[model samples]
Target chain A: MSEKGIHIEEHRDDEASKLGMWLFIFTELLLFGGLFLVYSIYRWQYPVNFHEASLELSVTIGVINTIVLLFSSMTIAMALTAIQKNNKKLALRLIAVTLLMALIFLINKYFEWGHKFEHGLYPGSDLMALLERGHLLYFSLYFFMTGLHALHIIVGMILLIIAYFKVKKDSVNSDRFVFLENGALYWHLVDLIWIFLFPLMYLIT
Target chain B: MDHNKTHITEYKVLAKILLLLIFCTFLTISITSFNLAAFTVTIALLIAGVKGFLVLSYFMHLKYESLLLRILVGSIFLLFIIIVLITFIDYSFR
Candidate 1:
């Protein structure tokens, strides 16, 4: 079918693509897992400071964000189901809802971080430097872990956006939905990391 | 497209799973208010692990994946645990 009368094949192996996505997710898990290891060790060394620092965090906001993410995860999962059922309209609507949830979550995080900045609680700030080593480490890990997770949220949002467009264009449907599936997988991974982060950062005893 | 191989998870089941996750989250938060000391982290993590499993199996559809894929995923977690344990041993002695 080419200009030279030679046939060319389009590589569209869905299973292989999904496998690659899962492998990428494995690396992400390990990346965050290492940070978690560091957090556990430091918490062991300075339990009291970590506890006190954790108390300073707004549990109400943390809980709200957790609920938002859980709901968003459900919406994305539902979006996949919609597409599987060949309901493009419902799928697009669900994806839109998921995107809105992501925005709400980031907005809440912005305000939460803004409040901390107002109190001069950021890493390398004078207030943080004045604190003991344990408190310093606590805030440092807090920012690093949550910050990384937020970055993932942004990336996942982009993926969902692409999936949204693909679904609209008919490139991804019930028969060809690997793109959407992978995007949902990425979103779920984001939610999963937050599941652990909520406990470690917000529920410190 | 292997239509026969694809699994279409029901919406009701997904909703139920989400409800369970939310319940577990609340349970974790409430339990932390009590003074369980060292056991608090363990309990919180255990609940989180359950929630993670639910998301993986239901939301991510890992439950319907091939055995090779499942093993690949499982081995990653296993290796991570082994690494964590080895590190704990070193830290404990020091």
Candidate 2:
């Protein structure tokens, strides 16, 4: 047999990459899961205080944010569908809409958190110090959980922005659009967390 | 491998799912107004679970994924529930 040059191949398995993303998502779920466990324990111990503190949250703002996130999730999912169909323009527009919704969500969160700060509900504030242990824990978990969620929103937004430009550049297109799919999955996970957070924080009072 | 066979969900189906999610959100809020006492939290969490499922299945496209991925997600949730239950056992005793 004739001597042959060594051949090296680079593999790009979309399914395997998606599986990796799903695993990362599971770790995220457990991360928040631990926080939720703490919240549940505290809520169990101080139901009345938790109820009172939860009532301080604005149902209107929570509802608006929920709707906004749900709509954004829809838009991102639709964006993936658009890209898969080779409709790059539509995909970009959809992702832009999703990003806009994320901004709106953050703005609402800013106002909501600001209103709470105005009342000194944050942890370690004199007002908070005066509150009972349950109220203290409630506000503490509220800030922690929602703050972490907001941070994820910022991260997901950045991911989508990168995906947006990639789609525009044709790097993420019909033949190879795993980037958009993975980005959309992360965005939906954010929405999924909020789906639980909204009811747990605002409605159960 | 035919890696190009992407599943493209219909726009109408996505719209319908969105509408259903909105309806569920409204339902959760309306039920909260009734002050169902002990059931309030349970009901809220149940609705949220349903909403989460919709987002996972449709929005995240978990429904379209392979069995291995489904099992992996399911196992993670199962483990979370176990940990939560075990913690509750400790708290309930105290």
Candidate 3:
């Protein structure tokens, strides 16, 4: 037999990578799940306080943010489609659109939190300290869950920017785009958390 | 083995899903004006659940994923519900 050269095959498993992304998603879900559990128990205990506290949140802004996040989710999903179709420019543009929407969401959030601060509604304020137990729990969970959610948004934006650069460098291309795909999944998870949070915190009145 | 071509969701489909989600959002807000009493939160949550499902199946493309992944994701949600239910039961009887 003729001597054969050693063939070094580069390891690749997109499915495994995606599965890993989902497992991480499971953890994320559970983490938020714990918070949601806390929210339910407290809300049940202090239904009236939760109701009045939720009324303090502007439905107009919550509605706007919901639309913004849903729109961003669509754009990111469309970006995946664009990449698959070899339309790199369209994909990047869609990603840019998604990022813009994320910025808009944060801006709205900033104004919303600013409104709260103006009223001494923030945690650790003397006003908060004087609030009754149920009302206090409501604001604390509000700051905690929404703050955690905003932190996730920042992280997702960073991930998308990195994925954007990877795609720009052609390190993640049409044929191999799982990295970008996973980032989009994480973005969707952010949207998912807000979907629950919006009604629980804003519309439950 | 030849790798099958990945499914590419149509841009139009994604746009439609967004519209549907927006409609659902409006629907929730509209329902708020009504005095459904305790049913208000329940209805809002149901709509949110629907929105979550749409985002999961379409935006995240979980619908097209393999059965194993689907079952796994489904079970995780089930477990979350179970945990919440158990906690509620404990607190309710206490």
Candidate 4:
């Protein structure tokens, strides 16, 4: 009860909050699911061209980014464990590690995209206009999917940043860390998407 | 306070899961070296599906979540699969 005549209670619901996040996650899954369907249909329609284009991508960079994102997911998961145990410092450090890994993943992406750009492989480039229809579709899907994934990583970074500050302020302590949980959930979702993207975009035919 | 009792996953467990995930990734890369024909992409995607299950279950704490929540999540994936199948069926027939 407050000093004012009217009394209002503080409301908090973690399950509902988490449910909300999961619902959003479902929507996100289908959004990418649509893209995956398009990719699969095209790969079916033009297997030879898809195989050749997949060969052009750098497997080394794709593998490195895969490992980096996996490591970051582990760190973020452990950060929640740390927070659960009331180890704020360790949680902070773990989140920092995750942020660093994200930067490393982006840096690798920069080099990879930079190399492709140097060869005029990006969308709308003169060289792209001259490529076969199938190859063009492959690269177009490549850019759109990976570019959207990168944007997600940036958004996850922002959520983590907010969670970091909240943790520091003790607003999201051991008892109330749903914000952190949701952020970590988002991060894991990003990693989940990459698990499939890495192979589809870089490996196989 | 949260609804369920707090279940703090061990750091070591997360590390182990990470190791397993990395091993799966290596397997994915290793298989690409061999010319398995059309089976190659199938294997790659299968491995990816397994890896995705791990991330969803362990990393995302879906396993620890309430049964209702788990069912809801599973149903969403099921719905997505059904849509994909219908789309494919339509495309292939057309």
**Candidate 2 per-residue C-alpha lDDT over A1-205 given as tens digits, one digit per residue, 9 for 90 to 100:** 2358666555789988888899899999999999999998888888888888898999999999999999999999999889888898999999999999999999999999999899777867899888888888998899999999999999999999999999989999988989989999999999999998998899756
The fraction of reference A/B contacts recovered in model 3 reads 0.84
Which digits, one per residue and each the tens of the lDDT, describe model 1 over residues A1-205? 8899998766688899999999999999999999999999899999999999999899999999999999999999999999999999999999999999999999999999999999988978999889999999999999999999999999999999999999999999988898999999999999999999999999998
> TM-scores of all models?
0.96, 0.95, 0.96, 0.96
Candidate 3 residues lying further than 4 Å off, grouped into runs, are A1-7, B1-4
Quality of model 4 by C-alpha lDDT:
0.92
What DockQ does every candidate get? 0.85, 0.84, 0.81, 0.78
Ranking by DockQ: 1, 2, 3, 4
lDDT of 1 by residue, B1-94 (tens): 4654789998998999999999999999999999899999999999999999999999999898999998998898899889989998999999
Candidate 3 structure quality by residue, lDDT tens digits, A1-205: 2358667666899999999999999999999999999999999999989888788899999989999999999999999899888899998998999999999999999999999999988989999999989899999999999999999999999999998898899888888899999999999999999999988898766
| iRMS of each prediction | 0.9, 0.9, 1.1, 1.4
Residue A77 lDDT in model 1?
97
Rate residue A47 of model 2 by lDDT: 88
In what order do the candidates fall by lDDT, top score first?
1, 3, 4, 2
Worst 10 residues of 1 chain A by lDDT: A7-16
- Candidate 2 is graded, for docking, as high
- Report the CA-based lDDT of candidate 2 relative to the real structure: 0.91
